[model samples]
Target: MLGAGSWGTALAIQFARAGRATVLWGRNRAQVEALARERRNCRYLPNAGFPAGLTVTAALTDALDGVEDVLVVVPSHAFRQTLAAVAATGVALKGLAWATKGFELETGLLPHQVVEDVLSGDVPTGVLAGPTFAAEVAAGLPSAMTIASARADYARRLAESITTDTFRAYTSTDLIGVEVGAATKNVLAIGAGISDGLGFGANTRIALLTRGLAEMTRLGLALGARRDTFMGLAGMGDLVLTCTDDQSRNRRFGLALARGQRAEHALRDIGQVVEGYYGARSVHQVASRLNVGMPIVEQINRVLYEHVSPHDAVAALMRRPVMAELV
Candidate 1:
């Protein structure tokens, strides 16, 4: 594992429980030291402790040494830097999977694309995504995820290794759809949170969610992803969970924004990088470049970047020209 944040820690613990010797690497040496000594991540996931066989380390080389399967769990923005470090280490990564769920802002590439570009075409890369919450997964709750790769055998192997009765893993060959669904849903969750903060009723929230699914499907289809993938765990399932749950950081950020807080202030109050904040801009850029009409995503960009009032953002969405549902 190449990240020590909540999700990384939680995943490390999960793999450890499966009797896999896991090494968790953190950018913060002090945080890594504390986790090594205390068996707990005090900052992000205080309630969870490291599994018995899991080891936390600050040394990059130590973590990468003799590791066969590498799971990169860092934030999307930090992926290139982390990959550069991996390249410098000269590790022959055979089976690598990324859990990061956003596009690189500078290059406008998905996580898999970044991996393919950075790894010199040496590694077999895949994605793991779904409706997973770190806290729930850490607590050994039931969760389902999709693992996608171009190679069917690799995807099947990954699914077999990662799946358990509690944690189910499904396989897909639609890597583009899997990634787009995961990235775009974060943007929609922010819209849902804004609705909640504005005291919108459940009916309104349901409508927003429905429309959000449509937008996600459109973008996925345009990107050559199968439409059915958007209705699966990585798409609608994730959107429903993140948008409706108060435990979601992106939704919390949106609520704060609707409550008259600046984006910076809201992020500060939330105390975590809401993927949707960066993801919204990326989605807007991609949609515009592809000529895909994602009006909900456009409104989110306006609210977050152009300082459009939340109320007015809602109005703008409503005022768009009406069309047939399937059009």
Candidate 2:
């Protein structure tokens, strides 16, 4: 694992419990030392003990030592840099995958694109994503996720490596669609949180997500993604789980903002990377470049960055000219 946040720690725990030798690397040395000494990430995923097979390290080389299949679990912004660091180590990676979800900050490149641009080597790669909460997964609750790669065999192998009695994995070849779904959902999840925070009822929240899915499909098709991928775990499952649930950092970020907290303060309070907060910018840039219509995303971007109030955004959305649902 390349990132030591809750999601990374949770996945590291799962890998260790599955009897794989897993090393979790964090950027902070003191924090890594504490986690190493305590055998659990008290700051992020507390109350979840680390398995015996897991090791916490501050050295990137130590984490990459004797690594067979490496899973990078960093945030989207750090995805390329983490891979570059791995490349700098000159280790020959066999099977590589990332659990990061979002577009590059300015370039709007997906995780796969970052891999291609950074690695430029014949390393089989995949993306692991789905509707999962780190706390729940750490507690050994039943969870299912999708592992997608251009190489079907590599995806299957990664799926098998992490799947257990409590956790299940499915494989897919639609990397474009899977990544599109994964990135787009975070943007919509922020809108969902804004709606819920403003005291909008379930009817409004459901409508927001329903239309959000449609907007996501339009953007995905523009990028040549398969339509069915949006209906699968990465799409509908993740969208619903993120937009409706409070466990989502992006959604919680939205909630805090709706309750009158500044973006900086909300992020500081959350103490984790709010991908949706950053996704608002990247997704809007990509959508505009692709000429895709995404009203919800646009409004959320305004609310988050332009200092527009949630109520005003909602009114702006309601005031738009009526159109057919399919459009």
Candidate 3:
């Protein structure tokens, strides 16, 4: 594991509990030392502790050494950098994957794009995503996620490796749809949070979620993704989970904003990476470039960056000219 964040730590614990030796690495030396000494990540995943076969390390090489599968769970902004480091180690990796969800800021590249830009094509690659929270997964509660790879064998291999009694894994070949859903869902989650915070009622919230799925589908189609993938775990399932739960940092950030907190202060209070907050601009950019009309995403970009009020953003959505729902 190459992140050591909440999700990374949780997955590391799961892997170790499955009796596989797991090494977790983070760039922060102090935090790494603390994790190694205390056998717990006090900052991100305080409730979770290291299993017998799990170890934490600061050195990237140590984590990469003799590993069959490398999972990068870093923030989307740091995805390229972390993968580059992995490549620089010159390890002959059997497979690589990420749970990271968002578009690379300037480049608007997905996790797979970042991987290809940094490493050789020979490396088997995939993405793991769905409606999952780190705390529940760490607690060994039942959770399911979709693993996608262009390589069918790669997807099956990872799914087989990670499945446990409490965790289930599904497989998909629609990597593009999975990634599109993962990245776009966070932004919709923020919109959901804002509406809920404003006491807009459950009716309004459901409407936003339904329409958000449509926008996600449109963009996915434009990018050559299977529409059915949006209806699967990585799409509707992930969107519903993130939008309805406060456990999502992106949704929490939106709640803070609806409470009238400045975006920066709201983010500071969350004290974690809110993928939607960072990805809104990039998502908007990609939507515009692709000529896909993501009205909700556009409105979210304005609310997040242009100082538009949440109320006004919601109003704009309500005011848009009616069109066929299937469109």
Candidate 4:
């Protein structure tokens, strides 16, 4: 595990309990030391107690030492820097996987793209993603996820290694679809939050969510992703969960925005990175470059970065010329 946040800690606990030796690394030396002493990540994952096989470390090399598989669990922004640091260590690993779900804000690259550019070796890489909350996984509740890679064998192996009776992982070869869906859903969740915050009822929320899926699918197809992939766990499952679930940071951040909070203030109040704020920019860039029509994403970018009022955004969306529903 290459992060010590709530999601990473929860995964470390699960893998360790599954009889794998897991070492969790955090950039914060003080927090790593505290976790080592307390045997629990009290700050991020207070209820998720660490198992005996789990260890905490500040040294990137130590975390990579003798490990067969390396799971990078850092936030999307820190992913490249962390991977570059690990590459500096020159550790040999059989496989690499990431649980992070957004593109790099600077380069607008997906997690795999960052890994490809930074890491020297041709390590088999995969992504583990779905509609799962760290708290639920930590509580050992039943959850299913999707593991996707360019290599089918790698996807299968990763799924087998990570899946538990309570935690199921399905495999897919549609890496692009998985990644694009994972990235865009966060932005849509923010829109959902704004709607909810404005006291819009379930009907409005459902319409936003359904249209959001269509917008995501359009972008995905433009990028050469399989159309059916958008209907799977990484797409529809993730979209619905993030949009409806109150635990979602992106949705809550949107709620804060609708309630008259600025983007920076809402993020501070959430006490976590609202990935949608960053993803909106990246997706907007990609959509523009590809000539893809994503009206929701466009409005989200304006509301988030351009300081457009949420009400104005909604009004503009409603005022746009009518088109065929199938478009």
Best by lDDT: 3
As a whole number from 0 to 100, the lDDT of residue 82 in candidate 2 is 89
lDDT string for model 3 (1-327, tens) is 999889999988887877788999999999999999889889887888789899888999899999999999999988988888888888889989999998888897888988888899598899999999999999899999999999999999888888999898999999899999999999999999899989999998899899999999999999899999999999999999999999999889888988999999998888888999988999999999999999999999999999999889888988999899999
Top candidate, metric TM-score = 3
Better of 1 and 3 by TM-score: 3
User: Ten consecutive residues with minimal summed lDDT in candidate 3?
Assistant: 11-20
TM-score of 4: 0.97
Writing each residue's lDDT as its tens digit, candidate 1 over 66-94 gives 98688899989999889999989987777
- Ranked by lDDT, top first: 3, 2, 4, 1
In candidate 3, stretches whose alpha carbon ends up further than 4 angstroms from where it belongs are none
Worst ten-residue run, lDDT, model 2?
114-123
Rate residue 227 of model 3 by lDDT.
92
Error of 1 at 145 (Å): 1.1
TM-score for all predictions? 0.97, 0.98, 0.98, 0.97
The C-alpha stretches of model 2 lying farther than 4 A from their native spots are none
Tens digits of per-residue lDDT, candidate 4, 1-327, equal 999998899888888877788999999999999999989988878877788999999988888999988998877888888888888887887899998878777776778888889987778999988889989988889999899999999999878876888989899998889999999999999999999999878988998998899999999898778999889999999999999999999999999999998888889988977789889999999888889999998998999988998888889888889899888
Residue 84 displacement in candidate 3 (angstroms): 1.1
User: How well does candidate 4 score on lDDT at residue 208?
Assistant: 91
Candidate 2: what lDDT? Answer: 0.91
> Ten residues in a row with the worst lDDT in model 4?
101-110
Candidate 4 backbone collisions, by pair: none
Query: In lDDT terms, how accurate is model 3?
Result: 0.92
